[model samples]
Structures are given as C-alpha cells and as structure tokens.
Target: MKKIVYAGLFTFFVSVISFTARAESTVGYFGFEPDIITNYIGPSSKKMGYVRVTIDLMLTDTSDIAVVEHHTPLLRDALVEILSKEPEEKIKSLTGREEIRAKCAE
Candidate 1:
C-alpha cells in the first residue's frame, strides 16, 4: 500500500509540473513590424494620405511566433494590398478600423 501511494504521488507531481510548464510556455505577445500604405487618394481625389499600421499577435505558444515570422512577407503584402484598396472614408472611421482589425485577425 505504501509503494502504491508513493507511485501515485509521483505521477501527480509529474503531471502538475508538465501542466505548469505548458501553461508558462503559452503566455506572451508578439508584434509584427509596422506597415505603411502610401499614395492613397482621399475623398477629394486630389488629396493624398498614407496609412500606417502595426499588428500584434497574441500567441499561446512560442512556436507560433516563429511560424508568424516565417510568413511575415506574405502577411505584409496581403495587408498592404487590403489597406491600399480601402477608401479614405472607410479608413478614417472607428468602425472601419475595427473592420480592418477583424480582417487582419482573420
């Protein structure tokens, strides 16, 4: 009976340690570089402005950071393309920003 109890305790301790390590490993944030979209014309069609954006990736795993970084170029290109196509009115509003955020998050 004593030997069984000891084995159980050992198993529990090992499981707790593994759970703690995994929990710790999955906590943090990673920010991508700023992206700028230039030469975009405003409502007036004559006035031009640029849109600058930075994205922060909420990561639950450290390995995800490396994965995100690896695809940074493609991600940047897609985001820039999306931002460049947006009209001045859409880009200037709070809702528009939220919409953009959602799109990027997706």
Candidate 2:
C-alpha cells in the first residue's frame, strides 16, 4: 500500500510539473495602448469618417513581447494604412470586419 501511494504521488507531481511547463509555453497576448484610430472614406468622396479599434497581438511565446513592443510603430502604421483605405460601408459590416481581421492577421 505504501509503495502504491508513493508511486501515485510521484506520477501526480510529474504530471503537474509538465502541465505547468506546457501552460507557460501557450500563446501570449499584447494589446495596443490607447487603441488605434484612423479615417475611412465615406459615401461622399470629400467626407471621411474615423474608426477606433483595440488591437491585440497574439505572440507564439511570451518571450516575444519585447520584440513586438520594439516594432509597435510599424504595426500601428500598417493597421492604419489598411483601415484608412477601406470604405465606410465595409468598415461597418460584420463580414467586412472579419475580412479586415484576416488582412491584419496576414
């Protein structure tokens, strides 16, 4: 009985440690501060509307946080460039939003 109990406890501890390690390796998220705001073209060529978006980047590893922080300016610029060119109609639709998300993911 003592040997059985010891073996079970050892297995549990090993499992717990491996689980913790795997959890640590899971994806990490970094959200842009103050959000991203950009202008999109409205129905009238002379008029433009602004859209505000909160962007979050999913990093393959938590250690990549610093790398993302370093390139935040470039990322923000790319997002703004994408959003600014979209029409107001597309910007407000659900499917269009998903399309924009897909573009961002690329």
Candidate 3:
C-alpha cells in the first residue's frame, strides 16, 4: 500500500536526521552574554576597577538546560582553576578575562 510505504519512508527520514544531529559544546555556545562585569575596590583606594568576563552559554540538546543537572559545573570550575593560576596582578586587573574564552572553547 502506498500509504504504508510513505509512512515507512517518513520514519526513515526522521531517523536519519536524528542520527546526523551533532552535539558539540563549541557549537552550542555556552558562555556569558554581552559581558560579565564585577567591581572590586581594595587596599584603601590603592586599587579599584571592574572585571569583565565575556562568554557564550548554550546547549546543543533540545532538552531543558539545567546547569545543576548537567556537567556545566565544569565550566565554572575550569575558570576558577585558571584564575587561581593567574598572577596576582593579572587577577586584580582582569579577574575573569583570560578564562572567559578558555571556558567557552571547552
């Protein structure tokens, strides 16, 4: 029957599309938008400025995104680790700048 044949073809097409759907974090774009800014004043006016963290935050899947339920914590952890490795001056000036790109690229 033509109807049966069409139904089978439709199912096969859907399967192929689902199988070909790619999931990659880099392609998903999970990071900060516009920018992430924070201010810090320390040492009795000896130092005062803002830190900007730029990033993209997106999910490749169609499911609802819940950072707590997903591996998204890895993103924050990586940034923290990188910040820990930065020189004191670097962290003071651009606290999360160097890490913004690195985290999203992961």
TM-score of each: 0.68, 0.78, 0.33
**lDDT to native, each model:** 0.80, 0.92, 0.55
**Candidate 1 lDDT trough over 10 residues, lowest sum:** 32-41
For model 1, residues 1-106, the per-residue Cα lDDT tens digits are 9999999999999999999988777656777655455456788978889988767778877778888888888988888878887888878899998997788778
Ranked by TM-score, the better of candidates 2 and 3 is 2
Clashing pairs in 3: 29-58, 30-56, 30-57, 30-58, 31-55, 31-56, 31-57, 32-55, 32-56
Structure candidate 2, residue pairs in collision:
none
For candidate 2, lDDT tens digit of each residue in 23-56? 7786889999989999888999998899999998
* Per-residue error (Å), model 1, residue 70: 0.9
Per-structure clash totals for the candidates:
0, 0, 9
Query: Best lDDT goes to which candidate?
Result: 2
Better of 1 and 3 by lDDT: 1
Give the per-residue lDDT digits (tens) of candidate 3, residues 1-106. Answer: 9999999999999988877763322243454334545554544567565555565555555353565237655655565455444444555545455564454456
TM-score of 3: 0.33
Models sorted by TM-score, best on top = 2, 1, 3
